[model samples]
Target: MIIVTTRQMQQMDKNTIESFGIPGRVLMENAGRGAIEMLSEHFDLEGARVAVVAGRGNNGGDGFVIGRYLMEMGVSVSFFLLSTRDRVQGDAGANMDLILDLLAEHALSQFIEIPDKDALEAVTEILLDHDLFVDAIFGTGLNADVRGIYRDVIELINDSDKAVFSVDIPSGINADTGAVCGVAIRADATATFAFAKAGHILYPGNFHTGDLEVVDIGIPGHIAKAQSPHIFLPEPHDIAGLIPARAFNAHKGSFGHLLVLAGSPGKTGAAALCANAAMRSGAGLVTLGVPEKLMPVMEPMVVEPMTTALAQTSSGGLDAAALDDIITLLADKAALALGPGMGTDSGTQELIKSILAIASVPMVIDADGLNCIAKNPDILATVKAPVILTPHPGEMARLTGKTTADIQQNRMETARNFAEKQKVILVLKGAQTLVAYPDGAVFICPTGNPGMACGGMGDVLTGMIAAFLAQDLSPESAALAGVYLHGLCGDLLAEDHAFGFSASDMVAGIPQALTTLLS
Candidate 1:
């Protein structure tokens, strides 16, 4: 499932037309038919009126094709042509002519041409008298904020009580960034072509697009794959495929071992959550290394995991002496999950820097461990391991010294840019967690709900990624699978609890969530 930018989508359409020999008109016909099928499934009208607010773009062409099909099916479709009928050129123009020709005798009674705002309002009033509204005013190619007649028409639809089905994408949404250029149509459902546009999944767009249905407009799979869009929307089967099924002869050694350095005195809960999550994520062996002083307190908390007591400072945090023991401990560990309850004490930061200096395996850095790295991020440039940094907006702001507002505003660019610069797998965790790979691909997760907003979520996510990495998943796959699993688990928990659910509860639901997916 590749998510394309507006430009990329247009390029794909152009390539199909020029290189692949698929004419633009043929594609437009298919696009229209595809959207109409989706519309027919949800809306049934033997003689009811359907209002189509059409523009001059291919999106309007799609609406024209749909309107023609509906009219052919014995449904009354009233077309409100925004621009002059003669201005519609190409396949869109042809379709508009065909619709008019079909209703030539009923032109005055069926097709309504509105060239002004007053006429548009009169058309909107007529549309309100109908049962369904088809919004084709604008599409993915819209780059600037809409105004004048078009904006008024979109507002008219929004104010209408009719069920609105947006064709392709809702008008006024920037297809690549999901930024609302101006007033965007709040559609009840959107039937998109081939794949979902990047804007369709991005924040405000996600909320506006009620129910999304991606229709296959008869594009060949190979051609679509050739587009090489750098974004992916993770699916359940995606995670299910990456998680290896255990062989009958598999043993503890078959599953990789994980080494987790976490927990301070008062923050021992973070360590417990991190280590427990690793085991729950199917790590064959997990070694929880904590300050020796907290070992007595942490030992009982983990039933299946083994605990190691390391040197502690007077502050009851991990000390530099633990570095030697950590090196010796890392010999057979397949992956390492650092941070969590690890405090930002000067000595602990030294330990983090020391661990990174020597680590050869993949590592997931989170929580205060990220805080330590933020003080001197250049250390990441020297680490030998494949590092995955999972940072929240605030942590990301500190790591890059950019305001949280900057990070949140352009999450995809911020994370991708930082990941490319730092040469690490960057997981910008927030409402829609973004996974930016070293190769420049990014995935925005769709699973999580508001329930997974409490403490220890990142710790659980850190452990999950390490578990996947230990199992031999590629860095991209591990981050993608981990984020998907983390959110899917949260979504499952959201069912039983209120919107204000806890991250700990979501952690408890991980095994159950995976079990459901596997089954």
Candidate 2:
């Protein structure tokens, strides 16, 4: 599903209204009717009292339409306009007129205009009496911090403990960035028009936007396509479509071989987990390459993956002297998974740079492999086959020289910029893991849960991507399928236990996830 920014959505809406000849009022009606349908699905509206808290904007117009429909259905409704009746203009003003006429006709419904704080206080008790609040104060255009009576009303609705349904987006969220603008309404559900905005899927806004439903508000499909949205939320079908069917008569050589360079003295578990996950993800053969000192440790830890010993530093990290051995290993290899347990010794860092500069196979770099490149990020510009860097916020921060907080705050922009500049596939791993391409397209993985916030999970993901690349999937397909599958594994585990599931447990669930996707 394509995800749009506020600006792109606005342009599409404008093009629909002006170019496609769909009137603004008709769009507002469609939005309102659709929201009512969603509201009925989520809450019992038969005997419920609904408070339609509206601003004097198009969003408020949507609220008026909802109130009018509620009254027609014989549900008790109250229209609380944040501004006086005359202040409403445009299609919203027109809807206000119609709703006012309905208010005079319906005996059970009432219209209250609270343009100031004093007027709001006068009806505070009345506002609290409703069982549900329809929040239509702010829409996708909200950028400034919310204050004054708007903040008070948002706070009141939040404190009401009543079911709150939002229109377009929750009030006080930056529709583009998902940042809370001072305060935001925590809705029970939100009915977004046309398409899901970036705010709806991004961080804090995602938390505020609960059970989101995208309502078709008469925007032409061609108009949306003309805008060329680059961001996407990959559904199950999207990931499933990327995976090729396996041949019935294929052997080990038919699938592809994967070479994984990882491991150090104390972190041999990282190497073992990554190598095991690669085999689990369907790699024909996986060779676990570790420093000579850790060969005994990793060899027994993994049963299926073949283990090899490379020259090691005194510190038990892969030494620069191992470059020739690694190059030999890369020959005829399908893909390379680098950096999971590799320590950041001076020799190990040099060895990583050497491999990165000369290796021809596609590579998925993670853990300390990413840390090694952070020291000389420009090395990414040097000779390289397709490369995918899977970096958590800390590693991403180091690569870009920004704080982790900064990276998290601007994940999409940061990932897109890095991928475009470096001409590589960049996977910014976190809550909604993003896979960004060199062409500036990005895919957001909507799987995984809080249970995935443990060690060795990224190592598992590195192996998955490497396996996919080895299986002849493009770098883009491999990254997308790997990220989605890794998250789906965690989600499967989450169905049984919330947060105690380990990375090994997720690895164990890969076959089940693949079955679920393939079936």
* TM-score versus the correct structure, for each prediction: 0.93, 0.96
Model 2: how far is 274 from its true place, Å?
0.7
- For model 1, residues 254-294, the per-residue Cα lDDT tens digits are 88899999999789989988888888888889999999989
| TM-score, prediction 2 | 0.96
Tell how far residue 353 is off in model 2, in angstroms.
Answer: 2.1
Pairs that collide, model 2? none
The alpha-carbon lDDT assigned to residue 154 of candidate 2 equals 94
Off by over 4 Å in 1: 107-109, 218-220, 313-315
Clashing pairs in 1: none
- Worst 10 contiguous positions by lDDT, candidate 2: 221-230
The predictions' CA RMSDs to the true structure, in order, are 2.3, 1.6
So what's the TM-score on candidate 1? 0.93
lDDT of 2 by residue, 1-519 (tens): 888888888898899989979899999999999999999999999889999999999999999998888999999999899989989999999999998877777888999999999999999999989999999899999999999999999999998788999999999998887899999999999999999988999888999999999999989888888876378999999999999998899888877899999999889889988988988899999999999878767878999999899999898898999999999999989999999989899999899889888999999999999999999888898847999999999999999999999998879989999999999999999999999999988888899899999999999999999999999999999999999999999999999999998989877889999999999
Cα-based lDDT for every prediction: 0.86, 0.92
Question: What is the lDDT, from 0 to 100, of the residue 355 in candidate 1?
Answer: 90
